[model samples]
Target: MNGTGRIQVARKVVGVGSVGTRAWVLLMDTLNGVEPLFLQAKEAQPSVLAEYCGRSQYANQGERVVTGQHLMQAQSDIFLGWTRARGDDGVDRDSYLRQLRDWKFSAPIEQMIPEGMTFYARMCGWTLARAHARSGDRVALAAYLGGSNAFDEAIADFAETYADQNERDYAAFQAAVDDGTAQATTEI
Candidate 1:
């Protein structure tokens, strides 16, 4: 929440993923049009990985998501919070809330130059390594990784297999849509 008296300047649904509903809200101080704040709220549900990894410790799914993000990210949004609201089914559902942006811009992944892509990939790898090191024994991980390309090759193979499986699943989904078994809305 804003410390000062900020009013809701605008609000809209964010057209992105199909996982759940997401909304963007803009707040502005009446006197300062240049310093508007934007926040995004997203509906949260039990993670699919829960089936194999066991249940989350947090009772609310929103809290679980926000907490996990806080743990994994080096820098987190200060406004991150969680709330529960009645869903369309008349049941309470959890939602994660946070600032949509904080002077940070995203690189257009599809249009990035090769050098930019390489930089982005390396940055992502470093960030992930930091997260892993924070959550696990750095020495043990280093030992496991070793000074070899074997692990890298194995990981690449796994990624290839995963991508192939994803493509096959997409094909099945397309077939279902064609046969009227499933209907997909692209407007989102």
Candidate 2:
């Protein structure tokens, strides 16, 4: 699929209920039904198999926890114009994240995740990368580390889980194929 198509799918996945739901969809696509297994591991054997994972890594590295306050500040700064124009109520992180994720999937490319309070965490890495590449600023390294690339990498890692899920789906379908009782397929 094209980038836009992938983005649409991501948006749809994100819009479902909570962050856990979005993660589940991605996991289902990547790992089959092993989400339960992972969840179990997270609870039972968390330090072993589940270590170095997305949220875990972020928390362990202290990046997310430490920079979280700054991220909020940055987001507020970026969205100052929007807030002024809209006269919207103060931003809450959870609500902002949901709206931002939705906006990312729905907005035109140019308007996608503009630099601001809601997007500060997402943009920090890219901004840092740009600054470092241009001026060799060490401070930018910290920002780059906190940027969207980190989130992108985390999401991409889940593709393995999705692949596992796809394999399971295929296996189930293949069993039907072997049984000679498979339902007739219909095109969309």
CA lDDT of 169 in candidate 1?
100
* lDDT for residue 80 in candidate 1, whole number 0-100: 92
Q: Could you tell me how far off, in angstroms, the CA of residue 136 lies in candidate 2 after the best superposition? A: 30
User: In model 1, what is the error at residue 184, expressed in angstroms?
Assistant: 15
Output the TM-score of candidate 2: 0.22
Error of 1 at 39 (Å): 1.6
Q: Using alpha carbons, what is the TM-score of model 1?
A: 0.63
Using TM-score as the measure, the top candidate is: 1
Give per-candidate clash totals. 0, 14
- Writing each residue's lDDT as its tens digit, candidate 2 over 1-188 gives 23222212122333333334222111112223332211100001112334555334442222332234344332422321111111135522211121232232333445556455447545656665454354445566566667557757776589778989999998999898878868646585
